[model samples]
Target: MKKKRIYISEAHKGGRELFYIQEVFKDNWIATEGPNIVGFESDLENYLQEEVHVGALNSGTAALHLGLILLGVKSGDEVICQTMTFSASANPIVYLGATPIFIDSEVETLNMCPVALEKAIVHRILLGKKPKAIIAVHLYGMPFRVDEIRAISCKYEIPILEDSAEALGSSYKGKKCGTLGEIGILSFNGNKIITTSGGGVIVTKTLEQKSKAIFLATQARDEAPHYQHSQIGYNYRMSNICAGIGRGQMEVLDNHVILRREMHDFYVNLFENIDGVLVFNEPSADFFSNFWLTAILVDETKNGGITREILRAALEAENIESRPLWKPMHLQPVFEGYPYYGAKVAETLFENGLCLPSGSNLSDEDRERISKTIQVVFKKEIKNS
Candidate 1:
């Protein structure tokens, strides 16, 4: 018989999703336009503690596309992006026929390094082309150096699309991630802190921006007695059923963040005495991460010759799932020719880091199984030494 497999991050239900779904079905609001969408957006606005506008969409990628569009990014333009995140963060720049200038991450946050950002900006401008916008990401729910990044954006006079897709409940200096930039986006993908099944939301500081996003998302129909259009658009609005799920997820968002943080705490204690495994965490009191997916950097030299890949393979043998960190975009074949700035921080992270199981619904038994499997590998390494 096969052992039970442990997933890295699984969608957790809050028990209220079904109730909300029933409400949507009962109200017969099966399309994208319905009360659920409004309720979900309102819930997010209240939770984020900002008077911001929210536009729900089909996926986080769509939200990014809309953000780039609203930032006036067009063909032949350039957009600066963090290289240490999922490709969604930079692909939108390419979607608009704009080139992405990938910047490396810093050691502290595993996010975009501000020094590299300014360097990229200055060099791009020196070459007679100012970047259309900046796409800063908070990778793995860890908030980037928000203050420094924002200062660079202001100094360069460029808009920023804050990619908070993996950082919905994360915050920096007491402010929510999505609300910190000119255009912010959240992902409710299955592997995220909260799942709307599959959806995303755009956070705008003004109603006009929110209105513009909705117009573009719903096929850019002009207000008329009959369907009219003057601009190209996309079908990216979230369905009512999915919004109902989102609303339910919102009710438990804080609790989910807490649970994910607890998972981080679990890794902290588990690796405390271990020589080579260091859990990724907040650098100071100012940054509060949702701890969406607890990651670790394994120092093979210090830890009995066990590398991240060795640890990952051992876990897989135990029917436990773990994954490597995102490969930096600049190193990807698709983005090779684009300009990149800064040191090898992102490369180091990718080479040594591994993501553990961090689902909110992970039980004590699951933790025990994970801990035991990890201990076995480390013990073998120690014995060999």
Candidate 2:
């Protein structure tokens, strides 16, 4: 019999999730507006602890789109984005007819490079089009250099849209990731720390911003008894059923973070002495990563020329799933024409990085199987050498 496949990430569902979903169905409030939706938004707002208001949206992408709208981004404007992130982070820029200027990642956090960001801002200003906003991401649950990036954003007077989709439980110097930016986005997709099944939320500092987001998300209806029309809007509100799942997920979020961090430690111990394999970790004390997905960089020069692809293939042969890091947006055919600034760090990471199985539900037996498979690969390399 073939071994079970070990996925890089998986959602953990429990009784609470099922109970909430059943309650939503029992209440006959499966659509956008319902008690669970309102309650979940309140829970998130309180968790963030910055007097921020939240608008539950249909997806992280929708939240990004609305965030752009809230920031007054318009056609022909330019928005700077981190190159090494999921496309959703940059796609919203295009949704507003604005161009995205890609900034490469720094090695420490594998996130936006502050120096590159400043350079991009200056270059854009020289071209007679200052960027309308900056979208900085906390990749793989690791907080970016928040202080440095905030300084740069402040220096240039550009608003920041924090892409904390992969970093809900992450913190920097005790401050939550999503609360630091002018506007922030969170994802509750199935593979994230918390699963809403499929949902997102927008976090903003003011009630006015939250109200505007809620109005726009609900199709921008004008005030009147009958059907009315006004500004363009989107049907991006989260369903009541999904919000129930989010509420349940929130109950166990801290446990999820602990499990993820444990998984990271396991990988670290597994590969620490391996000469060419370096696990990506928190760069310093200030960074408190949730370690969403344990990733590693394979330096072929020190590993007898064994590449990331070779290791990935080995894992695949054993029915285990692994994946390469996100390809920098600047290299994507759709984004090839956009302006990019920074060194080749992001490109290098794309070529050599790999995400290992890090599911919170992984069992001891599963870990043993994964460890043995990895050991076999290294042994084969050593024998071949």
Candidate 3:
């Protein structure tokens, strides 16, 4: 029999999604508005344990677009973004006809570098275009240098749009990640720590901000008996059906975080003795990562020329899925010629890093397969050494 393919990350149901989904169907609340939507938002607010509001949306991208709008990012405005993140983080700046000023990452967390961030701010202001907002991300569930970045934001008087899409269960210094910035967003895509089939939320510090987000999301309708629109709006609200799934997923979210951290430990142990392979992990006790996807940095010189690509190919040969780190946006064609700060940290990380299989539903057999495949790849170096 052929071995089943292993994915980098996949949705793991908590067994209660169907129950909530059934409740939605029973009540005929199939559209974007319903009790499930409200319940999911409340569940998220409670989970964060912070005084904040959440507005559920169809996608994290929509949350980002609305977030930029709320931040007052307008045409010709420049937004400072960490280049080493998903394009969704920067695309919103473009959506509102703004330019993106890309910043590099620090080696420790592979997140936005404060030194570079400040440098970008100072230099952009020198060019008569002070950035409107700072878009920082908690890459791969590891919290960014929040305090450091926050200080820069305060010093420069720029707001931070925290992208915690991959960090639902992660925290920094006991404070939740999504609540760290002035405004934040979360993703519940099929591959995230939890799944709402497809959903996200814009997290704000005030009910007024959340209300505005909801209003714009639902087509900016005015309070009238008839369809009346005074401003631009988007069809971005989360469906009741999807929120039902989210309500159930919330029940198992903490357990899933534990499982994902366990997967990170699995990789740490698997690569502990392997030269040239360094597992990505939290830098200190102040950080708690969900380990959304366990990644590694491969040093070819130490591994006798075995690159990350070679390891990725080996995993593919065994029907296991793996992928390279996100290519920094500054290097992509769509973002070329844009203002970029810092040196080659983001570029270097992209060249050397690879994300491994890290799904919460991986069985013991699956682990064995992944472990065996990885070890086999390194054993070739041992033989040649």
Candidate 4:
């Protein structure tokens, strides 16, 4: 018989998702606007606890796009972005006809390097172009160096659009990840910590910003009696049905965070005696990561030629899923030729990193199988070395 497959990350629905969906059905509120949409936003506001307003959208990419628009990013402008993250963080810059200047990662958090960031800022200014915005990511749910990055942002008078798509429950210095910058974004994709099936939100400091985001997201309809258009708009608003799922997921979000952290601890123990296998973790007590996907760095030179690719292939052979870390956006074919800062930190991470299975819904049996696959692979490699 084939071994059961393990997922890298998959949606774990709370029991109450159906209840809210049923409520939507009873109220005949299955469209884009409904009580569930409002309730879900309120739940997020209360949980974020930063006195910020959130605008729900159809996808995280939409949130980032709207954030750039709200930040006054326009054609012929340049935006600074962390190259070590998923492309969604940088794609919106091009959507607005702006250029994305990529920066490298720091080893500690695999996030935007503060030193490199400031250097990039100074260099860009030297070239007669002050970037319009900064995009920083909390990669793999690990909180970045918030104070250092924010200090650079403020010093240069640049607004930060925090990409917290992988860090809903992560925090830095007691502040939630999504509330740390001028604008923040969250994802509710099926593979994230929570699921709205497919949805996202933009976090803003004031109600005015939130209101404007909503206005732009909802086709930018002016208060005219007949249909009218002044500015270009998009149908990016979240549907009530998806918001229903979000409401139910919020009920269990804390539990999900705890479960994911437990998975991280499991990996810590599992790899305790495995030489040259270092689990990605927060560098200091000030950072709290949700561990959205537990990742490890495989140092082949120290581990007898065993590599991330070797382990990834081993996992795949057993019908289990694993993935390499996000390739640096600067290296992608679509983004090649963009100006990149820092040396090779981002490149090194991509060369050696691998994401492990970390679904909150994984069972003990699933973990046992995964562990056996990894153990067997390590044993063979160690013996040969």
- Off-target runs (Cα >4 Å) in candidate 4 are 380-385
Tens-digit lDDT track of model 3 for 1-385: 8778899999998758999999998999999999999999999999999999999999999999999999999999999999999999999999899999999999999999999999989999998999999999999999999999999999989999999999999999999989999899999999999989898999999999999999999999999999999999999999999999999999999999999888888888888778898998899999999999998999999977889999999999999999999999999999999989999999999999999999999888988888888778888322110
Writing each residue's lDDT as its tens digit, candidate 2 over 288-336 gives 9999988899999997888999999989998889999999999999998
> Which tens-of-lDDT digit does each residue in 79-113 have in candidate 4?
99999999999999999899999999999899999
What TM value does model 4 have? 0.98
Per-candidate clash tally? 0, 0, 0, 0
- Runs with alpha carbons beyond 4 Å of true place in candidate 2: 380-385
In model 3, where is the ten-residue run with the lowest total lDDT? Answer: 376-385
TM-score of each: 0.98, 0.97, 0.98, 0.98
Alpha-carbon RMSD, each predicted model? 2.3, 2.4, 2.2, 2.3
lDDT of each: 0.92, 0.91, 0.93, 0.93
Q: Evaluate model 4: give its lDDT.
A: 0.93
Compared with the true structure, model 2 gives a TM-score of 0.97
Model 3, TM vs. native: 0.98
Runs in model 1 deviating more than 4 A are 380-385
Indicate the worst ten consecutive residues by lDDT in candidate 4.
376-385
Cα lDDT tens digits for candidate 1, 105-138: 9988899999999998999999999999999999
